[model samples]
Target: MAIAVISGCAPLIQLDSDAQPSTVNQVELGQGSGRMKNEQPLAHLYISDYDSAAVQNARMSGMKLPGYKPEPVVTVNHYVQSLMHDLAANLEILSTTFSVGVTSFVYLDGDYQQGDLLGNQLSEAFMHEATQFGMAVTDFKTTDYIRVTPTGDFTFSRDFLELTQQYPISVVLGGTLVRHQGGVIVNARMVNVMDKKVLASAQAFIPQNVVHALKGTHSAPLLQLKASQP
Candidate 1:
């Protein structure tokens, strides 16, 4: 018995049940026969409608030019916020149980008592973040009485006599700054005033560009000096 199979638009293929299965070397078409010379199948190639030049030009036009990306503008507030986030995560004590105070950051290599404008700014930033994070903060510089003078009225004072005699701070937030070639390294820790045990600690790096953004000199003073000289 012979079985006939038709596939798509190709000619019919006949198989005999009594004959042993064998390799097909030739396939008969309607008017011609295609011969298979080797086991490898032949590939048919056709011309496409796409233009290589047009595709290349389109890809080049969409590609961005190679250059350095503009560095993000970071400030003291940003660095302090990052540090505060890390510190908050490591805090083991309850915020309600401890009243916190922030001090000016000191340089690692300089005298611990002396600090720069950057340290002062960092302290201020930390104070703001601490309050925002629901921690009770003590403003030791705030005076008990507001001083009114012909110059101006002030509630905050550096004068120890005018300020409160004592602050109810149980935890002190302080840090040290290390100057680096790329940036400044800030190491912050919250310590118990009674035993000096650290409750939480955090560290962050400020980029050189951000640290350099701080203005060191007043232009008004320089202009006044120049005018006086003339």
Candidate 2:
């Protein structure tokens, strides 16, 4: 099934500096920093599901309905991945780096919201998007932890560290979708998992009224999450 939207629940993106904030300490490349061309570039990256503070509050709150199924994060992993492809293409980095994870992904919806929920989990939609995008992706569990600042900075949660031990990912893609007074702001980033450093980042502002129209769907928000880039 689609990601169940909760009123005022969504991730917020940080929009500041050429660098995106991360819990991982920022690393500056010195004159001898080996990350230059001809060196082994960090190519096998991971793209994570976008998340927000509002979504977490609802899930942690103890008074939800029995059938309540909160979309833990903004359901836009594959979309963000597509954005990554665009980023790499524009930056001329795709030839050097690409995602190195499963092409097939599986969903873990803890609640039994639909009789055939498995048939319609957000993962299915993402799989379709991946196919359409011609991205070489496969089935694997994709879970990431991130925190955001009031002004739109990103920080990796401690839990995300545990995940690194299991996967060989060194770099990742992340962002936030925050509900604001006017509209939503997307603070997307390409992050280094090892040092929690931001490599490339961008921000987009989505008008609130449009979000309202999409939210009315009450279905998978992923089906209608569209943001602009410049």
Candidate 3:
């Protein structure tokens, strides 16, 4: 009944198929200057920090510091589940005309107690979301769920990439869960592994009220996050 969610193989910096970094050719920039013009290819650039208000709001919604005291396990479970539900709903609404698959989710942490709970919650969320989009994930059991953490002095682990290679999933999800500014924030990034391109990115800012519910006291927050079909 108790799974060591945090006891994953190893946390390694693995690139999803779509996210494999492409070589960027550099050209000298400026007159008589040995600097490369546009030295960083726009493709190699992550987080361009565009002018979108929604994205800006997400960026501005900073993290809560030091993290709140670990709440009741039941409360954390509920909040995580609710988040999965909302995410699924949004995916369904967006998958109308586009081909979508709720494949796998990988979390970053070393706590198996917390990681196990989070992984189950995420799987449930993905399933619910898949239904909304009229997509059925056939290999849930075979699907890879990973928790990445460091060991000793090493900064990354090898098990992390192994799972990715095994699953060879098309959509990869990664992010963090933190308490910030009086609430819980789940910053998630969804990437298309095949092409190594970022398909969609989102940040869920659960206000204090939602946090209370997440802790088993209040109602789920009403934040609408819908992705348009490509």
Candidate 4:
């Protein structure tokens, strides 16, 4: 009786096998499996030969997506370190024994007396790097008196009136920034204060993108205006 029961289901299994392919094809091809406009089978879509042309076209287009090309990872600190490293390599008489000071980098075309935020930041970064390189850097911006206020306790000031007129700096490290189309060229040098002689010099090019990455809080009038509108 069990053998007879198994034999009865053999024809039903064969019928299901024949219908399975047709049902799958109908679902994949969407309603009309053989009457579609393109009439290409699903297997043909996965063929390498059919996709070769598309792959070649994409290659020939030369499309550059953002972050596609590998760029050298860098920061303001890295650039400052590079400049200091070069300066160290080219030092004449400057060493750890000499007390050094860092001034803000100024624009090459400007009067050289005033500097911007970027220049101030570059000077600060150079100070940190100089200390790491074993140079004794003097903080001339520190005041003899600390101003204690409700907001915070302040010991540093840029005002010449607050700071002492003289510091024990033997060497001063300074730089100039020249803006170009692609980026800015930084020219850095260590100078003797008394004799006014250049001790060591170095230069590095900072890409505009990297420079723009420096973050700060500032007012954006255009953005404010847009936000105020409908």
Question: Which candidate number maximizes TM-score?
Answer: 4
- Predicted structure with the largest lDDT when compared to the true one: 1
lDDT of 3 by residue, 103-146 (tens): 32333343423443333444556556555546434342332444
Cα lDDT tens digits for candidate 1, 35-104: 2244333223211213223223323555321221323566879989999999999987556767999999
Q: Where's the lowest-lDDT run of ten residues in candidate 1?
A: 219-228
What lDDT would each prediction earn against the true structure? 0.69, 0.39, 0.41, 0.67
In order of appearance, the predictions have TM-scores of: 0.62, 0.32, 0.34, 0.63
Where is model 3 poorest over a 10-residue stretch in terms of lDDT? 1-10
lDDT of 3 at 104: 28
Considering lDDT, which of the candidate structures 2 and 3 is the better prediction for this target? Answer: 3
RMSD of each: 22.4, 26.2, 24.6, 18.2
Candidate 2 TM-score, true structure as reference? 0.32
**Native-vs-model 1 lDDT?**
0.69
lDDT of 1 at 189: 96
Instruction: Name the weakest run of 10 consecutive residues (lDDT summed) in model 2.
Output: 19-28
Q: Model 3 reaches what TM-score against the true structure?
A: 0.34
Kindly report which residue stretches of model 4 are placed more than 4 angstroms away from their true locations once superposed. 1-73, 219-230
